[model samples]
Target: MSARGFAQAEYEARLTRAQALMSKAGLGGLLLTTEPEIRYFTGFLTRFWESPSRPWFLIVPAAGDPVAVIPSIGAALMGRTWITDIRTWPAPRPGDDGVSLLAATLDEVAEGPVGIPSGPETHLRMPQADFARLRAKTARFLRDDAGITARLRAVKSGAEIDRIAHACRIAARAFARVPEIAAPGMPLSQVFRRFQMLLLEEGADWVPYLAGGAGPLGYADVISPADDRPLARGDVLMLDTGALWDGYFCDYDRNFAMGTPDPRVLSAHDRLLGAAQAGLEAAQPGARACDVHAAMARICGADEGAGRLGHGLGMQLTEGLSLTAADRTVLEPGMVITLEPGVETGGGNILVHEENVVIRQGGAQILSPWADTLARLA
Candidate 1:
């Protein structure tokens, strides 16, 4: 069994926090199934998340020790987590009575109104049978799936900020190393692969992964490299990479013009830099998150043809808080966000730049300290 990563006191504090949220929401207890939230509360990381045959459930009451219900085989791993008072069941085989075990566990702790994180965010995580069993037990059950969790996560703790900062540095350093591996006439995919390797060597847990190609215009989708197109003179190479450090991710992107730059590319690059700068400047205490987007949108214009500015970053590669005019979530201190400004023409000439920042009292503080200037690679 793995030793507990957090102290028992720390786990108690997390339970206190969860209970407080439940009280605020007028609920007796909460059932959380999200792995991130589970890991956050219990410091439990398991490879068994990949196995559907064995599932884990965390039942937290507003007034008692947290309960972890999982497979009998997984009960041993629960010792590594800070949480105690575990409930176990044998693996669900044909005609197995998993529901009896779940219902028994729930009945022991739940009273009054219980909260479950249902709907889109939670349906996939809970088994249909398990969900039905819980619903049948409590008539006062309400949908509170991830409601409190999102609010808690919005204001990151000091440890989380440190991890994000470390992740940001890894991404920035990886971007700085791009010039050495890129050259005109090399395939874009090759450059991407080399960049990924560099990130891995820098202690990043996974490839930051990059994309964009040579052309007169821009395209969508940065998840995969485009067709094996040979780099050409005056081609703008836009690279977007996300570094995963300590289970957190930092997304950073930059643009490099191969050979001599065209006037259009230079002008677009300037616009991107300006937009990114404006977005960063807009991040401050009490400012609505959408207000930052409105600032950047002003510079990028309402062109549906061009790429949108940047979004937020954290546990996932692309965080939902958009820096666009439509997003109105107020900005607050301790929030980390990404501001990426980009411009792409129909001809493949592209321009983009991104940076991660932590919102502070005065304004946003840049986490990744890389050059703001565009790179020209010949």
Candidate 2:
């Protein structure tokens, strides 16, 4: 069956969180640009890059219906969305008061500074012009409001968990077919395509935005598989993908070898796997996020410190809690996180290990079946 669709309850929960965030940020309203925030508030999903005629923005006030502002062409789609208010705009003209329109729509309800979802620049979605227009009119633009949503989003509602697990099951089954699709002499790109086809056959709504790459040390600079270079016997393949369903993300990464990997590679893989285990063990309610990172680092053995152990995963790939050094976020029940402890050796050997976990009363429940050992394709 096709992956379970987004439940209406999930949408309501997200909106409630957004409203709470608006209150906490001291903003009369929030303007959600073309990224996850817009999708979260309105359940509006479209080809974000293709629609450039008029930008799609979601106006979420502390109270009342969420108003979706988009180009006239997208109005139909927005109308079908769960959000109640759908506003459309014509293509901006020479004297178009695009900024004025935004102010007019928001000025009535919003007072005080409007909070923008301005996380790290990479996470900000909308074009520079629209972002600028909103900023100039709003007294204050804030970053990290993602928490307003992330805190709510990170905890997967029971139904949302079902959809994610379904997605993970699809990916796990797809990985089982990796050996068949991947050949000793096939290019990394070709292997990735086959992996994607398996996913599509399983009825994925869309191929995940993420992709993986593999090669010898020199070629391990992972790319999006546009370069379909064939694999060699000595190649180490990196398989990383974010499979999505119902707007939620199932993220995990694995490493494989076309043939028997070097002992150095094998050792590193084992170390990372151990680190992952340590991180999972530390993922209990009341545990801090950095404490999870510490567990993984200690297991990696001195001098073998892997990168940040993992991060929170849900609506957006990387969300609220991050398992990295210096972050002191406390873990809570219902939080879903990814534990990825990895190390890349100078010689080109890369060891990647990851799993999706949900914090539980007993400790942590592994959402995805754990991979037992390094997968050797050859």
Candidate 3:
């Protein structure tokens, strides 16, 4: 058996917490197919999920431990987890592909309504046809448990917080080295590659996301992939990364001026920083997610065409509790979220600033160090 990342007691507490929620909601069991949900319960971590050929399932009964119904190939890894009731079937089997096994497992575990995540920010991780087949075979009514899972996962455990904080520190060290690795005239693609390497050297297990833009006054979009366009002396360059440590992620970004940025860009950067500060000040327990949004929106102004001021961060690059007017999730202690404020800087270009923090009773505790001022790279 392989070593487990989380202690057995941690897994038990998570299971107990989820089961309590399930019972309260009148759910007989929860069928989790997504990566985060499965690993959150079972401590079964692997990067083999890159292949879309197989489907894995975890059944958390309202009364007992979770059961793993997965591809036969993963049985050994599953064995290493705190979960003991492991069931496997040969996956990628043209038609069945563990659908029957999953259905049977669900039927055995649940007698009434079964809960699954089918709502916002969640995608059914199995093949569509297989899902239909499983539903038909099991004949169990499935309810949307996305909200229950979201509420449970939003609060970071002490260990989860430490992992995320470590990842933030690693990324901060890497960002500090960007001036030595990146230079004017270098293509944005090379900058991306070198920065990813730097992150690994700084102790990040993997760099899943690295996106940014470089232009005379900020970039057109924050999510655009790095292009071959060379960085110019007067350009404002931004690099946002989602680096992972122990399956937890730190989503944050940094901005740097190649030589001298436009004064408007500098002003926009300062405004964004102030907006983030406002958001942080409002991120105490009992505050709603939208309250944080309003605080930042007041500083940055409304409708700059940016989607959200910030969002909950953990398990994935983005998660539940969006920092927008529509999201009313209470900012409870232990929730880790990002404060991202974006400003449009004319000509379809925009400047974005981001920082990660853990919500505390007192206020927001910043995980990543703030970029005191816009970095100027020679």
Clashes of each: 13, 4, 0
Q: Write the per-residue lDDT of candidate 2 for residues 56-116, one digit (tens) a residue.
A: 6677777877877666777787778786677666755424435556666777655655666
TM-score of 3: 0.97
Report every candidate's CA lDDT.
Answer: 0.69, 0.70, 0.89
User: Per-prediction TM-score, please?
Assistant: 0.86, 0.87, 0.97
- Of 1 and 3, the candidate ahead on TM-score is 3
Worst 10 residues of 1 by lDDT: 1-10
Q: In terms of TM-score, which candidate is stronger, 1 or 2? A: 2
What tens-digit string does per-residue lDDT give for candidate 3 at 101-197?
Answer: 8888888988679999877888789888878888899967888884778778889888888888988999999999999878899999999999999
Which residue ranges in model 1 land beyond 4 Å of their true spot?
1-13, 46-54, 72-77, 90-99, 118-123, 137-142, 208-214, 302-308, 348-350
The order by descending lDDT is: 3, 2, 1
